[model samples]
Target: MFSKACEYAIRSLIYVTEKSKNGERVSVTDISTAVESPFAFTGKTLQKLVKQDIISSAKGPNGGFYITEEQAKANRLADVVSLIDGNAVFQGCGLGLKICKENQPCPLHQNFKEIRKQLKKMLQSTTVAELAESQATQKTFLNNINRN
Candidate 1:
């Protein structure tokens, strides 16, 4: 599982991917509404993402969050997760051991190792643009995290 911040980051990512087209941008309020994320918390998450270059933003009247062409293409879910959560979610022991290891395997090591690996692959392999393109017509699950 991921933290609220991580979830907010992912959802905000969905908002940016859906609304911005490499150059286009939207206000924080729009992003909050689209992603059903809290303003203060999501804003904090966005600020960190901006610092990490996982996302981009601008100030002033016409300024807002947007992504670059290279960023649009290169930004993966893994990067966002790493920015917001580092490797905490994926690196922890699946069996909740005090300090499980290869020599001292957890009870569920054999069962969960492969699944965690697959999840990582899924997250790291999926790009923001890819997810946006896939959800072009249907509901944007990532973007519509907010109810309104």
Candidate 2:
């Protein structure tokens, strides 16, 4: 239910965070391959994240994108979602109506409202560090490829 850019942003961030936690920085090419995103698109998304201070970058030898422990703890999935997709996911009408409100609800408004509330809570509660840990421990997989 997220935009393509948002999906890549989340994946790329988690990959970077995982590697960073292990004291390694990741290159754009490596991140794109790891996350199965286009290199240019991943780079652009990384730039946006860096600009917003959600991630960090260095240059020259021994330089790439990484997240600090403080940043990892401070950021939540909701922050990335809001940064890339705004609050539309939390506030927009489910039926894509230009104007759907409580009084003038869409067909799926009430149901979607509840779903969105739950989604918002989940995203807000999930930290980047937690996601990275899950990935690092192989508790979760980012790509669809079967490692087995």
Give one digit per residue, the lDDT tens place, for model 1 in 15-69: 6876776457887888887778888887888888889887799899889998776
What is the per-residue lDDT of model 2 for residues 5-104, given as tens digits with 9 covering 90 to 100? 9999999999999999889999999999999999999999999999999999999999999999999999999999999999999999998999999899
Summing lDDT over every window of 10 consecutive residues in candidate 1, give the lowest-scoring window.
139-148
RMSD of each: 2.7, 1.0
Task: Let me know the TM-score candidate 1 reaches against the reference structure.
Answer: 0.87
Taken over the whole model, the C-alpha lDDT of each candidate is 0.78, 0.95
Candidate 2 clashes: the total is: 0
Judge candidate 1 at residue 54 and give its lDDT.
75
Model 1 pairs in collision:
34-143, 35-145, 35-146, 36-145, 36-146
Off by over 4 Å in 2: 144-146
Q: How does model 2 fare in lDDT?
A: 0.95
lDDT of 1 at 135: 62
